[model samples]
Target: MDETHRDRDAEGRARNARPRDGLGRPLPYGTEGVGRQPEGVVRSPEETLREAQRLLDGGMPFHAHEVFEDAWKSGPEEDRELWRAMAQLAVGLTHAARGNAVGGARLLRRGAAVLEAYRARGPYGIGVGALIGWARELAGRVEPPETGAVARPAGRGRATGGVDAAAEAPRLRP
Candidate 1:
């Protein structure tokens, strides 16, 4: 693609014009794709959590990540880490569904740690502990196959290679 044809926002920053799948994977141009969350929208913490939960419940962790990303970038400094960790958790789930076991596990652990640490201090109405458990469960599932160790979903849900795992996703405000 030529520079002249690149997708550019009003600020002249380059953005991918390519449509993305439900998991946020870029698709070839001209191919119809799932609708994604809008970028840079400011919302209250409640609104962000609500919308992100909706996306996560609908098996769209990648989209949820974008919502959290918006919150992370636009929210008050004190809450930035909370949103950033949420985004990381969502992306970690995305990797798990994509079957990148090592990457997925790493991210899940990283996000879980952040959230857990934050929980000790303050996490508002968010169920930080439950969210940590959910991420940890998924992380255990994403362990390398050669390890002969994998955490089975205990009536929570199943992994379907990133297709749709709503049951396996966490309820953010439980």
Candidate 2:
């Protein structure tokens, strides 16, 4: 078989090897390509949170969703809800970035709902109350930007007048 044919098979295998991207999109093959993160490779909570924050701050919420997902899948069971909620938040941002206001609002509210129970104690030092408040506020404000508007300066995504402005990466509370 030719190298091209062999490469295609290898890519297919890699695509099935791990979790998909935020939108459930299948990642391309190879290290240089966009692929899912390796399974069973969990990181420290601090490390994962920090990395997710970095991705979000960089205007890459879709990538951040991947990190949060890993934490949800591999982190301690006790922390699963926290990670899942965080992942949902990231995906919500992803939807907003892609200009899907309704989907974004839905995910944002859903995530906040999961987070509500944890707000009293502030799990993992995360400001659960603040995050919940933020999510609810964001959900109310989400509205897709007008067509042909200028994107955000940092290449984060399209920025609408009200809710979109708040959609930028939220500061993770200590």
Q: Residue 11 of model 2: what lDDT?
A: 40
lDDT of 2 by residue, 1-174 (tens): 222433324446622432344434444444243444444557888888788787777666777778888999988889898889998998887787666676787788999999987988886678888888877877777855446655444324343432332337787775
lDDT of each: 0.80, 0.70
Model 1 misplaced regions, further than 4 Å: 1-5, 145-163
Please report the candidate that would top lDDT against the real structure.
1
| TM-scores, each model vs. reference | 0.83, 0.69
Q: Report the C-alpha lDDT of model 1 over 20-92, residue by residue, as the tens digit.
A: 8878888888889989788899999989999998988888889999999999999999888889999999888
Q: Give Cα distance to truth, residue 82, candidate 1, Å.
A: 0.9
Identify the candidate with maximal TM-score: 1
Q: Cα miss at 23, model 1 (Å)?
A: 0.2
Root-mean-square deviation of candidate 2: 7.9
Tell me how candidate 1 scores on lDDT: 0.80
